[model samples]
Target: MKPPDARHSQAEDARLLTDQNELARQEALNGLRQFDAVVEMVEYHLQPEHRFRFRPSHLLHLHRLALEGISSYAGTWRPASIQIEGSRHQPAGAHRVPELIEELCDYVNDHWQECTPIHLAAYVMWRLNWIHPFTDGNGRTSRAASYLIPCLRAGYLLPGKQTIPDQISQNKKPYYEALEAADAAWSERGTVDLSAMENLLAELLARQLVEVLDHATGGHVTLPSAKENPSS
Candidate 1:
């Protein structure tokens, strides 16, 4: 029985109520496609044959892309603002940027084996954004970075992983609201509570999961694919 809103948007309502297995399957595929697109945008390889094993070089390349594409400036890296609390604001030197980049890479490498791919992914992304390593595109870079976990996780856990930018970007009020909320819960130094960060990620992940499932399992999805991974 379709609900009153069901007929209006089949893609969205298709799986308003579906079995757990079917929902999981559809989401996997979406995750794969989105992850592939994002990585490809920055000339990163997916290595589908390997089931999306995350490579450091590729991940770094993707992060650079997000930093480049998402930032307001095309090819520069500096503090966008005083950074109310994004990361640190100690007048990072040009050379220091590379060092900071390494730190981020090292963090990912260190956690690659310790946490759930999703947990690692979410924390890295949130932390990266909070770090605001780049002057511009910090938002876009962070988002792309975040996708890595879900994308790879999907390959390992599900068939495909879909993009969640659309679901998350919706309603600027809630979008920014979530960001603000997460930021507040985060330590003044920008360090976040993993549990809180995970919860926030869970909401986005869960919503995207639904959208992916809705159209993924032989149904039509309503949310349009992110035209270009969000404007930043």
Candidate 2:
């Protein structure tokens, strides 16, 4: 059932960071905290007895970190419908968010062993954006969750100076294109064809790793093509 408060007014949901400059500063600070927290959480969950299980709470916690001082809606599912700018895809209704997020977690847990790290990460990134569960920080939370899944699956944090999330944020054209590709596939058929997104992750991950190697070797290292890296 749609909750009585499911139609939050735009004015009521206005951000706490009224100043654009302050908002940008907070975004930078919050992003650091969010990334550090994700790494720490990944380490904690890596313990043999404390295996990771993707849950709705995980997303909420990450969202909270991403928008703690920026939005009044931090740490919670959006209470009203939101429209994605520059795209035709409509987010799931506020009433459907909780169930959709639950299913997303289930998808990760159900295929934890079978899916490649890149595939799992790509799926999480795309699906969470598709769900658009939070009133704010959906992108931040989605990217954080995407990084978390692969780190947990691999049993350790992945190494890189610039992570997949970091790269995507720096220049989002390719990222948006990949997401659009997946959306088009879903519209054409009921399948989750994440090849484009998967490929994007694979490429960015390789670039990140190569940067690490270049720094480690003092610019005397040879790197393999992204396609050659089976780890992605």
Candidate 3:
């Protein structure tokens, strides 16, 4: 038999692991609740003749929602530089985030009519990921902001049992590849090349719409109800 101290240490380790897992689960639940709230707000702004203008504050608010229970830094820009893992791309310096975000908002507002909704949404997602404005939850915030673009520009929430954000999270390889492709193009030639990301977004949106059609035609998939929260 093992020594009593050894047995006690194993038990203590197990308890710590369990506690960590439970904390992760609770954090996920809270994030989902916040995502639902953000979705509701997006829908509200998309109402007829509401005239919503995309702004830096909107991104800040969405970031806050995405990390409501996970990080104290939610809804605020990072004060220190951040690095992306497993990628060659580097985000802007911490001090430049505020100005860059303002430029992003202004660019979107000015080009709202010039670009198609899908292109615009893709740009937002890619740029936010590139900016890495927050200390954590940047991807979540970016995806949420990306969803908001199509809804706001198209004047309604896109219907689906699964959203683009869900699809991106489920299969991140393609998403990351697309972002990296855009990054490479910009880094090499100083031009914003979002065609790859645009294609991915288009495919996801198409799949989402197809899912909606299937549900309407008696498919087995259940649509997200008003009370349904996003899965983190």
Looking at model 2, which ten-residue stretch has the lowest summed lDDT? Answer: 1-10
Provide the global lDDT of candidate 2 against the true structure. 0.84
Q: Per-candidate TM vs. native? A: 0.55, 0.90, 0.82
lDDT of 3 by residue, 1-232 (tens): 1111110000001111236776688557756865686678777787767677888888888777766655567678887777776667778788999999988888789999998988888889888888888877777778888888888777667788688988987888788888788878888899999999999999999899978778678776766875877874
Would you list the rank order by TM-score, best first?
A: 2, 3, 1
Off by over 4 Å in 3: 1-19, 219-232
Q: Say which prediction, candidate 2 or candidate 3, comes out ahead on lDDT.
A: 2
lDDT of every model, 2 decimals: 0.50, 0.84, 0.76
Kindly provide the TM-score of model 2 when superposed on the true structure, using C-alpha atoms: 0.90
lDDT of 2 by residue, 1-232 (tens): 1112111223236589889999999999999999998999899999988888889998898999998999888898888888776666788789999999999999999999988989999999989988888776777888898999878877888898799889988887788887777877787797899999999998998888888888899989766675796776
Clash totals, every prediction: 14, 0, 0
Models sorted by lDDT, best on top: 2, 3, 1
List of clashing residue pairs for candidate 3: none
